[model samples]
Target: MDASFVIHGPSIKPGTEIELISNTDVAPTAAQLLSVEMKNVDGRVLTKVMM
Candidate 1:
């Protein structure tokens, strides 16, 4: 069986769900949310979840 995952934070809206996300995308997503730029990341940011 596969494990389910969640990304929770104060800026994130409750009950939001996104599919087909890569584990490698987490870092880039966080960086973008914090107004930090990332270079040469393995995966792209999950922009759909952004406000």
Candidate 2:
């Protein structure tokens, strides 16, 4: 499968790009954005995109 992610908003920097990410990361990233913690996960939040 081909996977790509894009984010656009005031909190996100313009023209940011991520080379790769796993499917499991999507949920964790969303949780981070909501300021919620995720437990018992095999993946982690992709903080690079937020910067």
**Candidate 1 lDDT score at position 41:** 83
Model 2 vs truth, CA RMSD: 1.3
Taking the tens digit of each residue's C-alpha lDDT, what string does model 1 give over 1-51?
A: 445657777767678788867778889989988989999889888876666
**Could you give candidate 2's per-residue lDDT for residues 1-51 as a string of tens digits?**
886688766656688788788888889888888888899998788777785
* Model 2: pairs clashing at backbone N, Cα or C within 3 Å: none
In order of appearance, the predictions have TM-scores of: 0.70, 0.79
Model 1 residue 50 CA deviation in Å: 1.3
- Candidate 2: where is the Cα deviation over 4 Å? none
C-alpha RMSD for every candidate: 1.9, 1.3
Against the true structure, candidate 1 reaches a TM-score of 0.70
Which numbered prediction scores highest in lDDT against the true structure?
2
